[model samples]
Target: MSVDNISRADELVPSRYAVPVGDIEVLVISDGVLPITASTLATTTPPAELAGWLDDQFLPRDVVDWPLNVVVVRTEGRTILVDAGLGVEFPDFPRAGQTVARLEAAGIDPGAVTDVVLTHLHMDHIGGLLTEGLKARLRPDLQVHVASREAEFWEKPDFSHTVMPQPIPDVLRRTATQFLNDYRGQMRTFEAECEVAPGVLVSRTGGHTPGHSIVRLESCGERLTFAGDAVFAPGFDNPQWQNGFEHDPEEAARVRVNLLREVAATGEALVATHLPFPSVCHVATAGDVFRCVPAVWDY
Candidate 1:
């Protein structure tokens, strides 16, 4: 049968996708997309090999669009937000910083969010916690939780020795300080692993940052994992590939490989920040590598 013509919206709008884990609901809210060069992804992989992989996948070898996903978990009485997106003031990427608007569209009130769990302290992950001026906290009354090691590192950053460029460390330090000061009393940190909410647990994965972590949601008998930036797109298939943004490439690869195995074995759903839109998927072992099977949308 021939398909009928359909009208498309003129203006772009933020997208949101929801999934249920037993009694709890998890919403994948889009902050926006960031266009990054393919070379920036697999930093250590040879250019020829990287190009061949992209070609095989039918993807562009030049620039790849990475999505910024902010997750919101709704339970019986609390609204928990994971990894705030880049806020309005990020000069580098004008298309980003739409987390609040997207969250609102998903029926979540920013003010009603009782807790904000940060998987790490990268600018893209923590920028939405404050207002444009960076003078005040956006979710004022909420308890903001980050990894203890992450907090310590940012508290006194040594720019001379890091994976990022010279200016990034300074910028990150300034923003992180502002966020910590603004929410002084409400900020909390965890060491290895701890439960932020009833069934919401944060576990330190490290590598991407000294304090990088992943959030696991358990409700009834179902489970969902917010993998953060630990395992990006093509990296999932090649878990040992070095990522340009990782603080320690070797450690990052180890963490990713271990996590992928666990996810594959247990059959838990994973939501990665840089994966394709509506980034919920399952992992399957493919010989020594792994593959991501995007979850089917349910009506």
Candidate 2:
């Protein structure tokens, strides 16, 4: 279940984009790709409406490929891994279990991971916590941080009522049992807007998933926010479009609009877990819609 071992430094990193913010190096890592069907998008936004929005953007009428991104914050005291990628469970998924290998290839020993921040308990964001044996993999000593709301929601037997793609609710229920058994004392919860690390703060960005949070990093004069699933693709600003997997489409759309305005006004570099590969980009407002100008960085 492991990828071929290669030199950590010499191995080609997958579309990694890094920017030095004071003493911290924010490296955006791509786990792989997620393919969503038209029906999937319709679950949140009507298919016809979504197609119309896509047409306006000049995008294709086929499937949408959302690349999985994990942000790595390297600071002097700790190596903070923000959200593990979708784990090895989905054999059919192209990038289901590559997060660990990619991090290792980038010179990051799994044992050195001090914290695994869970934006939410969605399978794609947290399935990487366990090994093939279902044992915790990130340093045995590392702590798993999650929002208090995220823990409570996943623990509920009726958690499915809040998630889309009905199959996902079942996945969360099963994963919850495994996580509790393996991550016992290692799991901790945080209140809203708490600073977990130097230059890193967790902010509530619900609507995508209850307890879903985004991490903000600021150092010197540079600022970068890992927006998690708050804004699904740049298409979010299309007040006419709704995200494909949002828990509350209306609320998610509202939050995204506000966030887009905030980040656009702040002029900070931002990254998302499901944006295209090397997803670091600067946000800008265009008329009523928002546009993403990918940050130019050498691989």
Best by lDDT: 1
For model 1, name the residue pairs that clash: none
lDDT tens per residue, model 2, 219-288: 8988888888886664545644555566666777777788888889999977888777777788888989
Could you tell me how far off, in angstroms, the CA of residue 20 lies in candidate 2 after the best superposition?
1.7
- Number of backbone clashes in candidate 2: 0
RMSD (CA, angstroms), candidate 1: 5.9
Off by over 4 Å in 2: 2-13, 42-44, 55-62, 133-137, 157-163
Give the number of the best model, judged by TM-score: 1
